[model samples]
Target chain A: MTAEIKWVFLYSLLTALATGLGALPFAFLRQVSTRGLALAESLAAGLMLGASFSLIAEGSHYGLTQTLTGGAFGGLLLLAGKRLLDGHDIQFGEIRGAGARRILLILAIMTLHSFSEGIAVGVSFGGGQKLATLITLAIAVHNIPEGLAISAVLRPQGASLLACAGWSIFSSLPQPLMAVPAFLFVETFQPVLPYGLGFAAGAMVLMVFLELLPEAYEKADSENVALWTTLALVAMVLFQTYL
Target chain B: MSSTPILSLLVAASVAALATTLGTIPLSFDLKAKRRALSAAYSVAAGIMIGAGYLLTLAGLESRPSACILGAVLGSTYSFWLRRVTGSKKFDDNDLESIPVEPKEVDRFLLQSSFHSAAEGAAIGAAAAVALPLGLFLAAALAVHNIGEGMVLTHRLYSPQATSSHPNAVPAPLLWPTSLPPAALVVVTKLPQIVLAMGTYFLIQVWPEFLPLALGFTAGALFFLTLTDLTPFAYGQGRREWVALLCSAAAALVVLGQSFFL
Candidate 1:
């Protein structure tokens, strides 16, 4: 196998193991209060804000008209997606007690989310090395919460720990699955590279506004949310300077 | 042994990694006060990102408008496809409230979020790895941004309840767990993404012909983020709409200024 393939295998294995092992912490923490949860949510909001600014803004430096046009296109696409999927539903995996339609809907939503993440990974790789590592790390950090969210949803449905683990693993399967292929033969797929990156960026931007930020507002006080957001920005600045 | 290229790449990668890690530190705090602090941080980071994109990516690829348009179209189309395939679910207050306290579930959430962040980091690293000085600068900026993201995410998972009870709490001392499984997971998953990102950079490094395309692709990603994510998030709530707009404008201006002055 090529050196690149070896790296891909290692990454995929590590990600799966980390995700599975990460789940163990919750068992010990037991119960977290609602107040605590809100605080955490706010923080997450801030971090996303910082990330969006630092990564996306930096991305724009490549070109003005082109970047702006691309951004506009991406925004419109997200809006379109929201409109199309507004009331639609689908399902996947093993269905417990929920109707087949509901299960399908859940699965579909999960797939959509995961696919966006996969695209992000693919795009980040376009940058190569350090940039890719940064993107991967950021995505991985964020995935922990996503895994928790998925587990919470599945737990009520009589899903076992192993099952939850499986789902969590499945949810992120697209990241490495996509990354490895993209990396191994980026030359062959050169034509679509820019578009793929753009798609991922657009999707991520949409996710932050449509999902993450709104959730932050719902859970935390306005002031607290604002503060966390600011901190997130500061953190970004500091990281840039120090790193 | 003129290893300037490799040396610079290492510098860029390390810097990117550190920035992302540092940015994520505040996220571990589970306090309401800390959350607000994190939000403010995000706004600033957003400013930096917007500025960087305009100054670096846009300036570098000014020759290729068509590629940029194409990139954007592809991005939006993909997002549309995903949405069509899966219905959107709005997260409620109750969902947030139940986050931190719940056992085992939090771990999964953290892992997923971290994974996402790592992917972003990898992209930044790759950009730096290929472009050298220009990419390095962007990577540095992105590293800072990723750190903020990490802080925000960490705070979300740790203190979900703090927001609901004290909407106006003062910023508190932020403390992150030194040995969380999620953190380790984030670092581990980042390894390959970084490598792939570097490989991409290598390709670009070898063939200067691809610079325009690379720049265009990066521009597309940034542009999509600014218009779709940052702008909307800034304007989402009626109260923060103006602030968001101002921030967005300021961010753009910073880049404009850099283009002319820097």
Candidate 2:
């Protein structure tokens, strides 16, 4: 295999293994501070804000009209995802099932989430290793909670801690499987690369608005989130100029 | 040193997957962090996304103006239509509470996570085609990005809907999860993006010339994404409202180099 693909596999494996670590927490702690949780989201938002603004500004370099058009479309794409989610009546209180069933249901959903994350990794690679690395880092950080989530369910069922951790790792098995094909096929996927980029961008922006920020507001100070975002923006700008 | 696309992508995918698995290994630890800390993390992450979106992706895509614009237009229109149909729910921040765990709720979380995965996967694949540098950068960034995302998902799973008796509970305020299954839901959600990304990448391979356009589309899509997804997170109740604006302006100045207003 090419060096690039080799790296991809290594990275994916590391992240998957990271998921298993979630179960370790069940051995000791029962609760995490709300502030800590909020910090994670805010930090992510800050980073996203900086990265996203720079992306738009960079796009503006080509032509104001072109970037604007892309921006508009990006917004629309996110709306579509929202529509899909909203159309379905997904009330947590309304649903009924045993813990095992609940776990399965959630497993199905999260698998899909992991799949998208894997694609995000592959697509970022199209930008370059730097971007891909950053994206990978983001995904890796997020996976901890994901693993914890697995344990949250399995642990309650009296499943062994090891079993819970094993399942957590199992949930994300598709990532490596998918990354291999994406990494090797870069040359082959040239024509539609632009569309893919646009699609990813659109989705990311929407994720920020519809998913992350609102959620952040639920837990922390909006101002703190905003301040952090600005700081991150400046940091990123410097990183880009200097790095 | 020679390798096939499938082999290469598989390797990369594996490494990323490993990161997630590794993250889970830490188990539960009591973090003393508060809302301020979490907010800071989110904002920083948002900034990173902005930077990657522009410096790493959009700037490069400028070469193909026509394709870029077309992609943006379509992305915006489609997104707009979707929002119009579903609409936003009136939400309150204080609605976080524990609720009954059920199978159906878990299903909802998974379905939502999966839909998002499709989008994320396609994005990763598209960016991957740009160049090795960008692909690598995206991989790293996404790895970091998932941490915050995972935390957020876990919170929902851990928190519950307001129980009827609780004074903190609202009839329909924050869209909190009702049970603990959501924790598992969060981890598994990252799965599909790789498959979708690789699949999409394969599709793009059929037509090599569209690479620039593809990149442009990514730019446009990200631009809109920033507006809708990341923007609101930066705003606060009062004095902090300017935080997002100021940060945005600074970013524009550095990135656009004086053409920020233009």
Leading candidate by TM-score: 2
Chain A structural similarity (TM-score) per candidate? 0.56, 0.50
The positional error of residue B20 in candidate 2, measured at the CA in angstroms, is 5.4
Q: Write candidate 1's Cα lDDT for A1-243 as tens digits.
A: 477555554554444444444344344434445554545444444444444444444444444434434444554555565555555553335543322332233333444444434544555566766776676666566555445544544443445667666776776676666666666665654444333333334443444444444555565543344444444433433343233
Per-residue alpha-carbon lDDT of candidate 1 for residues B204-240, written as tens digits (9 for 90 to 100): 5677565545543443344334333333333332223
> Across residues B1-262, which tens digit of lDDT does each residue of candidate 2 receive?
2246556655554444334433333234443342333344445445444554554344433555456545544443444344334432111131222232233344445444444444455556666665544455455555655555555445444443323334332222234333324334454666676786676566667675666556545544444444443444334221232333333333333333223211
Ten residues in sequence with the least summed lDDT for candidate 2 chain A: A191-200
Give Cα distance to truth, residue A111, candidate 2, Å.
Answer: 51
Q: Which 10-residue span in candidate 1 chain B carries the lowest summed lDDT?
A: B87-96
The DockQ figures for the candidates are 0.02, 0.03
- lDDT by residue (A56-105, candidate 2, tens digit) is 54344345444434444554555554555554545333233343443454
Question: Best candidate per DockQ, number?
Answer: 2
Instruction: Give the runs in model 2 whose Cα sits over 4 Å from its true position.
Output: A1-243, B1-34, B56-61, B80-109, B160-184, B234-262
Chain B TM-score of candidate number 2: 0.65
| Stretches > 4 Å off in candidate 1 | A1-243, B23-32, B56-61, B76-98, B101-119, B122-131, B159-182, B189-193, B225-246, B253-262
